[model samples]
Target: MPSLDTAKAYYEYFNQKNWDGMISLLHPEVRHEPNQGEPRIGLELFKAFMQHMDESYEETLTDMVFFTEPNDERVAVEFVVNGIYKKAEEGLPAAHNQKYVLPAAAFLGFTDGKISRITTYYNLPLWIKLVSE
Candidate 1:
């Protein structure tokens, strides 16, 4: 599969909460760059991050639009994260099932038909305000 297909599957699996499915599309030494954070490398670290995320939030990606370069080595996707804060995360408000809509995007890098890197972006303050209200 090309980078675009892998990216579509990644978000599909995420919305379905299929962590293993998401992992299957990743390279063994995948690098994850969360918005405003240090890059995390390797599948194991990715799994741990996913587990932590799963425990805290219930989210679905909506209004998705994907873009790619001619060589298909990279892909960028835009979407909205419709989510409910299920539990508390560090430096965030107490969770009372607060719902938030966050517009987000990701840049994907592929290696051998798998995603080797992912850098994601979203508005943190908007999320905080929406959920806090």
Candidate 2:
């Protein structure tokens, strides 16, 4: 099924920093749930969020393991985020290309040959500690 492939490609594009490629895999009405923020809706809104993420940080997902529902309607991926705080966005702290590695996961739903829902989870306090060091 395309679920696993699509999910893999999504992360691959992300690792490549191919923002447009990553966006291309999103459904038109995609909804994004961040680890510590309110839900974001629609492709355009997600695009804006991606733009902000791109500007604020650099990251790659590693050690990825994928799981799926029986009908492949949904997928979950667990991975490690190797990231650098390239710029300050949130009020967490000032950035100076600080590098950190943390565990993370994302749940995804598929629709119309693309991912329609993406919800991510990670440890905020751990990330803060890592970057603050």
Candidate 3:
């Protein structure tokens, strides 16, 4: 499948909260980088991170647009995250079911039809301000 198509499918799985389906699309050695955190290597860590995210937040991506090069090895996605702070995360504002809508972007690398790396970007301060209100 095309890289953009794969990215779309990945987001679809994400929006559906299908962790297994999302994991199935990742390479065994996939690397994940959050907006303001260290890069995590391997699928196991990625799965753990997903679990943590599931426990802390309820979110969905909207207004997605994907960009790719001719080789289709890399894909970039721009979207908005519509989320509610469901549970308190460590070292952050208290969760009171606060709703937030933030613009975000992600760059993905593909290897042999599987996602090799994913790096996401967003405004953390803006998110904090919105949630802290």
Candidate 4:
């Protein structure tokens, strides 16, 4: 459990669209659940998930802030993520080439200086409304 530096680095990696680079900051057995669709466990699956996101949207997290829990073992991040879909996103309400900005929250759990688990939640209705507009 470090400080905001590590957390900021993680976001920077994501913002840069560096999927593989971000993977290096996770543990081998890291687990990720994005808005409860399905849990992706292990480094390979997590990388795959990021790859899917990279392929689906041109997005960035703006106005982001991180709140680290006690001992810095967990972090709660709040941000507004904006994306323009070039390829249809898996759960999107529309076909393609849509733009969206959604408020999102994510919990990150860490161990041994890397992320062990992450859970993300977002406003679905807001996402739909924006992307489908």
Residue range with the least summed lDDT across 10 consecutive positions in model 4: 86-95
Runs in model 4 lying further than 4 Å from the true structure? 1-3
Please give the TM-score that candidate 2 achieves against the real structure.
Answer: 0.96
lDDT of 1 by residue, 1-84 (tens): 878989999999999999999999999999999997789999999999999999999999999999999999999999999999
Cα lDDT tens digits, model 4, 43-109, are 8888777777777779899999899866878888999988887776556575577877788988888
TM-score of 3: 0.98
Which regions of candidate 3 are displaced past 4 Å?
none
For model 2, how many clashes? 0
On residues 25-108, what C-alpha lDDT tens digit does candidate 3 reach at each position? Answer: 999999998888799999989999999999999999999999999998999999999999999878899999999999999999
Give the distance in Å from residue 108's predicted Cα in candidate 1 to where it truly belongs.
Answer: 0.2
Candidate 2 residue runs with Cα over 4 Å from true position: none
Best of the two (2, 4) by lDDT: 2
Over the full model, what C-alpha lDDT does candidate 3 score relative to the true structure? 0.95
Residue 92 displacement in candidate 4 (angstroms): 3.3
Candidate 2 lDDT tens digits, 9-101? 999999999989899999989999999879999988998999988899999889999998888789999999999999986579889999999
| Every candidate's lDDT | 0.95, 0.93, 0.95, 0.82
Structure candidate 1, residue pairs in collision: none
